[model samples]
Target chain A: MVKVHFTSHLRHVAPSDPVEAAGATVADVLTDVFARHPAVRGYVLDDQDRIRLHIAVFVDGTHVRKDILAAPVTPASEVYVLQALSGG
Target chain B: MAERLYVSTRKGLLVYARDAKTWKHHATHFLGAPVSIVLPSADNQTVFCALNLGHFGAKLHRSTDGGVTWTELEPPKYPKVETSDAAEKEKAPAVAQLWSMAWAGPDKPGALWAGTTPGLFYSKDLGATWELNEGLWNMPERARWFGGGTIDPALHAICVDPRNSNRVAVAVSCGGVTVTEDGGKTWRVAGKGLRAEFMPPDQQFDPVIQDVHMLAQSPSHPQMWWVQHHNGIFVCTDDLQSWDEITTAPISHFGFPVAVHPKDGNTAWFVPAKKDEHRYPVDGNMVVNRTRDGGKTFETLRRGLPQGQCFDLVYRHGLAVDETGDHLAMGSTTGGLWTSPNGGDDWMLLTAHLAPIYAVRFA
Candidate 1:
C-alpha cells in the first residue's frame, strides 16, 4: 500500500488528507486515487492522459523525472503530487 | 448605450455595472485564472466564460442568474488521433485557447459558435456539449496554417450572417478567411485580395495564408465586412468574395480590434499600434481611428486619450461597440480602460488599473 497526498493548491478542488492505496507503480497509485476522487484526474493530467507539464510527482521522496507514470513504487511508498513553481 | 460591461482579464473576470451614470466594479469571478474569452448569450441572460488555466488546461463556466451564480460546463475538446508513442504523440493537437465565440443568429436559439486555437466548435445546447467542425478541420489547406500571435495556429474570428444563420464567416490568424453558407456543413476560402507580406513573393497574395488579426461585420449592412490584417486594413462589401485594402490610415495600418457601426456600414473604428515585434501605441500616442465614409477617409480621434510616452496595446477583443453604435469601450494591455459615450470623438478614462484586459464586452 502507498500513501497518496495532494498539495494545498489541489486540495481546494479535491481531498486534502493523505490516503492509502495499493499499487505497484505511481500511475497505478494515482489511478486508484482518481477512482475515489474522479475530479482530481483532470487537475493532475492533461487531455492526452499525460501528467501536466507544470506538475511534479514524487514517490518515496524521489522525483519521478521521466516516464513518470511508469515509475516503480514500493508497496509502502509515499507519493506526493504538487504543482511546479514556474507559471508565474 | 450599454449600462453594464464584462472584462476578461489575466487574473479573473471583472464585471462593471452601471450605477446611475457611473460604471462601478460590480463583481469578480474565477479569481487568479486567465480568462481568455467572455461572451453573453443573444438574450443577455446567459453568460459564458472561458479560462486557460496554467496547469489545469482549458475550462468553461456559464452564469444564468446574471453572473451571481455559475455552473461549470465542459469546454471544447479535440478528438484523439492515433500516434505511435508518447514521444511521437507530442504533435497531437489540443485546445490551447478558446480564442473567440459568437451566438448564432436570433433565429437559431441555443446555437453557439466558438473559435479555438486549432479548430472551430459548435454547441447546440448552449455549450452543454461541443462538436468540432470536421469539414474545416479535414481540409488539406489547413496544413498551411501556422501560429501567429498565439502559440498555436488559431481561428479567432466568427461572424454569423445577421440575415441568415446558415451563412457564417470565420478568420484564422495565419490561415486566411473561410465562409460557409450552410452553417458549418461546408466551407470555402474567401478574402481573395488579402496579402501576406511575410510569405514568399509568389505566395504573398495567396488567400489561403493571410494572417488576419480580426474580422468584423456591420450589423446594419450584413454584406459589409472589415478585417484588421497583419499587413494592413481591408474591407469587403461583396460578402468577402474580394477585399479592398485601406491605404489611408493616419496612424500605422497595423491593428487588432475592429468595431463596425451597428446602423451604418461605412462607420468603423480601430486602435492602431506598432506592427510586428513592437506592439504598442504608435509614437507613444494612443488614438482610435474612425472612418465614417468607409476606408477612403479616417479621423484620428485622441481626445481624452493618452499621448506621449504611452504603451497601451489593445487586443482583438479589447474594443467593443454597443447596440446603438454610439457607445464604445476599449481596454489595453497596460491595464487601462476607457469608454466613449459619443462614438470615438471623445473618451473618458474608466480605470487606469485592471488586470491587463484580454477582452471587454457590453452587457
Candidate 2:
C-alpha cells in the first residue's frame, strides 16, 4: 500500500489519509487514486491525459519531475501532489 | 481570531471578522474592476488601493476611517509638451496605467509616492498633488527599446526605507530596480548579479533587469532588501550595489509578490506557483513558503489552504503584514482571503466566494 496524503483543501474531494492501490508505477497508483477520488483527476492530469504543468508529484520525498505517472512505485513508497507556484 | 481583516477584489473591498470559529463577512463593494494593490497606513486609520481598469486607465482610492468609507484620489495629469523653436509641435508624454503606490512615512502620513506603467511620480502632501520624477524618465536606458518596439518600463513595486525618507527603491516591470540616495533627484540601476539576458531572438530583452515585481526592506537593516523578479527571488545589500541569488526553491520564478517579516530581517515569505503551467496556483493548490534565515532556505506551509485545482494568482500587492506584527494576510484569485496569525504555519479563510482578489491590507 502506498501512503497517499491529500492536502487539506483537496480533502473535501478525496480521502484525507493514505489510500491503497495495487500498481507498479506512479501513474498506475495515481490512476487508482483518481478512480476513487474523481474530483482530483483533472487537477493532476491535463485534458490530454498528461501531467499538468502546475501539478508536481513526489515519490518518497523525491520529486518525480519526469513522466510522474510512469515513474516506478513501491509498496513502501509515499506520494504527494504539490502545487507548482513561484511567489508570495 | 479577533483581529480585523480587509480584502480587495474585482468588485471592490471586503471587510471581515472571525466570530466563534467561522469567518463572518462584514461588507463589500468599494471599487470597480479589480483592486490590484492595497496599502494601509501605519496608524491603521488610512487605506490606499490601486485599481486596475485595463485601457480605461487606473486610479488609487483612499479610506480615512479604517475602511468604513472610501474616496478616489485624482490621478496625476501629464504635463503638456511644447517646443520653443515653434517649428514643430511636441507631443505630451504618453499616459500609462498606474501599477503601484507607496507612502514614505506612516508617522507623518503626508509623504507619498506613486509609480505608473510609464514612470515614477511623487506627492509630498499625501495624494493631493503630484510631480514626475524626471530623473527616472531621463535615464537613457528608459528610452531604449530592447525588443524592436518600445517598452513603457512599468513601475510595479516601490519600497521606502522607514528609517530614512531619502533612501528609496523602486522596481520597474521590464526595468530593473532603481534607487535614489538624495531623494528622487538622481537614480541608478541596481541590477548586479541578476540575469539580464533574455531568451529567443524576439524575446531577447532582459525582463528580469527591467521587470521587478515585488520588493521588501528590513526595518532594522536599512541597507538590506529583498526583491521578487519575474525570473527569480534576490537579496541585496549596501543599497543595492550588489545582490545574491536566492531562487533555489523548487518553485517557478515567474511570480508576482514577496513579503518580509515585520520584525525579523532574516525571515521573508513568498508564494510559489507551478513554473510550467499557466503561472497560477499549481493545479489549484495553495502553498506559501517562509524563509526564517533570510532567503538561504524555505519550507512550505499549507496546513489550512486548499489542495484542489484552483487558479488563484497572488498579485504583487496582495500580501501584507499586520500592524501588530503578529499576523500575515493575503488575498487570492480564487481562494478569497486568508489570514495566518502565527506567521504561515496555520491559516484560516476569512471570506468565501469573493471576486478575484488583486490586493489586500489591514486597517
Candidate 3:
C-alpha cells in the first residue's frame, strides 16, 4: 500500500487527503489513483502522458527524476504530488 | 432574441446577460484560475473556458448550464518526440497555454481548433483528442518565425470559412498568417501587405515573418477577412491568398484586437494603442477606431469611455460582437469593461475594475 497526497491547488477536483493504494512502482500507484479520479489526469499531464513542467512528484520524501517515473515503491512509501514553486 | 457576454479575465470569468436594453452582470466562475480563452459554441448552448493551472498544467472546462456548472475536458498538447539526449528531451515542444480557439464551421460540427504557444492543434470529437498540425510544424521556415511578444512564438488567431469548412486561415504572433484550402494538410503564406519594421530593410517584405496581432472575419461575408498587425492593418478578399493594406487618416493602424460587424464584411472596429516603447492608448486617451467602408476611412468612437491618464489597453481577443451586430464589448489590461449597444455610437462601462482581461465572447 502507498499513501498519495494531492496538493491544495487541486482540492476542488480532489478534496479527500492521503488516499491509499496498492502498487509496486510510482507509475502503478499513479495509474491506480487516476483510475479512481480520472479528472486529475489531464490537469497534471500533457496529451502525450508526460507530466507537466511545473508539476513535481516526490516518493518517500525524495524528488524523483521526471524521466524516471517508473521508480519502484513500497507499501510504506509516501507520495506527494505538488506544484513546484520555483520563483517568487 | 437575448444576448449574453462572456468576459474572461486574468482572474476569472464574468457573464453578463442583456435583458431588453439593460445589461447586467449575470454570474462569475473559475474564481482564481487564469482563464485565457472563452469559446461559445455555434448554437450558443455551451461555452468552453481554457484554464492555465500552474501545477496542474493547461485544462479546459465545459459549461452547458450557462456558467452554472462545468465538466473537465481533454486539453491541447503536443505529441511525444523520441530523443536520446536528456537535455534535448527536456526541451521538447509542449502546449504551454491555450492562446485562442475557434470552431471549424457550422458544417463541420464539434470540430474545434486551438492555438497555443508551440503551434496549432485540431480536435475532431470536440476536444476528446487533439492532433498538432505538423504541416506548419515541419516547415523549414518555422525556425525563423521567432517570438516578439513573449519568449516563444505563439499561434494566436484562427479564421475558418463559414461557407467551406476546409478553407482556413491562422495567425501567429510573430509568424504572420498561413492559409489552407484543404483543411490542415498544407498551408501557404498570406501576408503580402504586412511589414515587419524590426527586420532589416531588405528582409522586411520577406515570407513568414510578420507580427499579426488579431484576425477576424464576418460570418455573413465568407470571402473577406481582417487582420491587425503590430505595424499596420490588412484586409483579404481572395480567400486568404493576398492582402491589401487598409488604413487611412485618423487611424493609428496599430492595435491589439480587430472585430468585424456580424452582418457586414466591410465594417470593423479596433481599439487604438501606441505600438512599441509605450503600449498604452494614444496619449493615455482610449478611443475605438472604427471603419464602415472596409478600410477606406476610419472614425474614432468615444462617448462614455475614459480619456486622460487612462492607461487601459485592450489585449488580443479582447473585443467581440454579438450575433445581431448591434452589440459589442471590450476589456482592457487595466481592468476596465465597456460595451456599445448602438454599434459603436454610445458606450457604457460595466465595471471600473476587474483583472487584466484576456478575451470577451458573445454567447
Q: Name the top DockQ candidate.
A: 1
For B1-363, candidate 3 gives per-residue lDDT tens digits of 446788888789888888877679888889877898988875557788998766677788887766677888878778886877767666787777898888888777888899998588998887778889888788777888888778888888988877787888888888988888899898888878777777899988765888889888777887788888887888888767678877582637678899998789999998888877688988888899888998898889989988789899899888888878878898999889998888888888989889999989886
TM-score of chain A of each: 0.93, 0.86, 0.89
What's the CA error at residue B198 for candidate 1, in Å? 1.5
User: Where does candidate 2 stray beyond 4 Å?
Assistant: A1-88, B1-4, B17-24, B29-32, B54-56, B67-71, B83-94, B106-109, B145-151, B196-208
lDDT by residue (B111-205, candidate 2, tens digit) is: 78888756688887767677888988787767642211124667767888787777788877667777887788887777676664344454433
Query: Weakest 10 consecutive residues, lDDT, candidate 2 chain B?
Result: B86-95
Q: Rank the candidates by TM-score, best first.
A: 1, 3, 2
Q: What does candidate 2's lDDT look like per residue over A1-88, in tens digits? A: 8877665545545787777776888888888888888756644553334565556678999988866777888888888876665332
Poorest stretch of ten by lDDT in candidate 3 chain B: B245-254
Between 2 and 3, whose TM-score is larger? 3
Q: What are the lDDT figures for the candidates, one per model?
A: 0.88, 0.69, 0.83
TM-score of chain A of 2: 0.86
TM-score of each candidate's B chain against the true B chain: 0.97, 0.85, 0.96
Docking class of 2: incorrect
TM-score for each candidate, following the candidate numbering? 0.96, 0.70, 0.91
Candidate 1 pairs with clashing backbones: none
